[model samples]
Target: MAVQALKDYKFSPADAQEKFHGAQLLYVGWDEHLMFCAPFAYCLPPNTLFSDLCQKFMAHSFGYHPDWKSVDFSKVTWLKSGQPWQPDMSKTLAELGLKHKDVLRFQTPGLKGINGTCS
Candidate 1:
């Protein structure tokens, strides 16, 4: 039963692995205290926009309910290699010097901006 449940899990990455082969796999996380949440691994396309990635994180990590739409994109900030990730001012992942398994920290609205370390 447990194995079957794992197979049916909503966030399964089996398909994504096949589809995004050779794509950079980035670890995205919402900065949280007490380690209450888990970071998401994304198979980011080479030309994916920063804004689009932010939206995708919100939708997938937080769920796509009607209430999620009210969240402001302006307050969304990402940190890569300890530097701020600007959506409007940045280019693609490859252009931004991001490699596979790079961890990007996300600072969301209403959450105190605290950097969390991934082991």
Candidate 2:
């Protein structure tokens, strides 16, 4: 299965961004070279490979065991800390009309706080 996926995956940055046409994105943070595209429209992460996001998404989405070291995540756009997240988010969420209850769900991120973030 692993070999098959790797062989068939046409991992392209442009293809990914296009797949999520008009998706309302929430900037979680940066990973490797990719941004975490968590959309407010659904509790699940948007189908974007903004970093190594696609690998984890594949693991979660397919119920596969994520042996990160074995995965060749050389396709992400990595960034560093203390750097601005490009399109700025301070004025971003304020534009949405969503309520607190609307975004609440089991898979909602940050619920685990720092514990879930620590490597």
- List lDDT for all candidates, in order: 0.62, 0.32
- Write down the worst ten-residue block by lDDT for model 1: 110-119
Q: What is the TM-score of each candidate against the true structure?
A: 0.57, 0.19
Candidate 1: where is the Cα deviation over 4 Å?
1-20, 33-36, 64-70, 112-119
Model 1 agreement with the true structure over 49-100: per-residue lDDT tens digits: 7656766654766553333454576777778866886656256777776776
lDDT of 2 by residue, 55-97 (tens): 4433343223222334443332222233322222232233333
- Residue 78 of model 2, lDDT score: 23
Clashes of 2: 7
Error of 1 at 22 (Å): 2.2
Clashing residue pair totals per candidate (backbone < 3 A): 0, 7
* lDDT score for candidate 1 against the true structure: 0.62
